[model samples]
Target: MAEPHPVLITPEWDAPATVRALCTTRHGGVSTGPWGEFNLALHVEDDSAAVAQNRKSLLKACDGLEQIQWLNQTHSPRCITADGNSLPEADAAETDHAALACAVLTADCLPVLFCDETGSQVAAAHAGWRGLLDGVLVNTVKQFRAEPETLHAWLGPCIRQPRFEVGAEVRVAFVERFVGPSRAEIENCFSAAGEPGKFLCDLATLAALQLRALGLSRVSDCGLCTVDDPRFYSYRQHNPCGRFASLIYRLP
Candidate 1:
């Protein structure tokens, strides 16, 4: 059974009054078993009717949100401009349209919400390790009409550094993006795990670094970890877990 009221985490950045952003927690919905309740992703094998009902409830919970309008999220760097109705094959989405939210679904993967300093546009990106390494955030940033320096971003909950163990190959791949002293900063985001050839990666810090590199000075986070925090879902902790959302939109 779903909770009477769904819990939402609003970003604590300095965005203008015209822009709004939030991330959903796994506390409201009607899926059973591992999905339990509050499961938002339909592709996770949750009951179709229940999922639809949950989605409807989500719309009702959100004051003027028109729809979630999920992307196919292929883990590629693809980002698309959305119109609030078309489901596209991309990992990120952006829009200036009011009431039509841009959203990304995630379990353990990082979901990022973005908006211009003046609140003219907004975007959401699903950044799994692959997508993050592949520049999904970069592509999402490019969709904004505002300069990178004029953007504010909020990092949603995900598997944090202490629990996000990655192979050496992943670290090597990410390191390849940098070449000098800046590379050391990126390298600091990955610490050696107790296990040989494994490293614990700080997904949020890594994301913040990339955003800073892009000139976005106002990056903030929910400061929560998905696997350790029951408020959000974690695919690493529950392999068949449901996905939650991080979303943004303009208000008319």
Candidate 2:
């Protein structure tokens, strides 16, 4: 028998007024096979019925099923402010609009949820390596219309440093984008992998650097490693695994 689905909540550092955030695990939904139970992604090969049930369960666990803006992530820096039922094809979603939740699906990519401390806005992003390298996080902060320093960031579960391998070209891309002595801080986020032309990348640290560069010092990470933790889905560890969801909503 499959285990019950698990739901992970962020700490107080991320709990802005009316902002409710949670990351669902693979344990609770109705998906079977490699996506066994609780796979919320409609793009996966799971039974449509199973995916529906998983989504239903997730909505019940997080908030009432009104309408959440689910993005069609393309690993790009694009972000859209959604107001209705239209599922926009973008990498991030945000709103000061009440009752409409913002969400993203992920296996190993970083799912970042954001809200201004003043409860004026909320947003979520699927920041995979490509998205991150291309400035998705920075673009996300801009969506709130506040100085990046006033926003709070909570990084959901993702593949950790020891398991996230990247090429030298990836590092070069980041170095070229970053400014000042902080260039070394970005480089230090990578470690020498045994393989040439490759290094171990730290997604969390990279995100922190980006947040710091934007002057946001209140970022807090959940510290859960998707690849290292079996309770969550991990694309790097299991290529065919189902994706879990990270959702955020503001109360009316």
Q: List residue ranges in candidate 2 displaced over 4 A.
A: 1-6, 12-14, 178-181
Q: Per-residue alpha-carbon lDDT of model 2 for 12-112, expressed as tens digits? A: 56566567877788886667889987788878777888887777666666654366787778898888997757877888989888778889999999998
> What is the alpha-carbon lDDT for the whole of candidate 1?
0.85
How much does candidate 1 score in TM-score? Answer: 0.95
lDDT of 1 by residue, 1-252 (tens): 535566788889888988878888887677777776777787888888877776777777887677676888789889998877777899999988889889899998999999998888889999998998889998989888889999989998889999999999999888896322277887998999999999999988888888988888899888889999988788889879888888888887
Predicted structure 1: clash tally: 2
Error of 2 at 31 (Å): 0.4
Candidate 1 — which residues are off by over 4 angstroms?
1-3, 178-181
Model 2 / residue 189 / CA error / Å: 0.7
TM-score of each: 0.95, 0.93
Q: Which ten residues in a row have the lowest lDDT in candidate 1?
A: 177-186
Residue 116 shift from truth in candidate 1, angstroms: 0.6
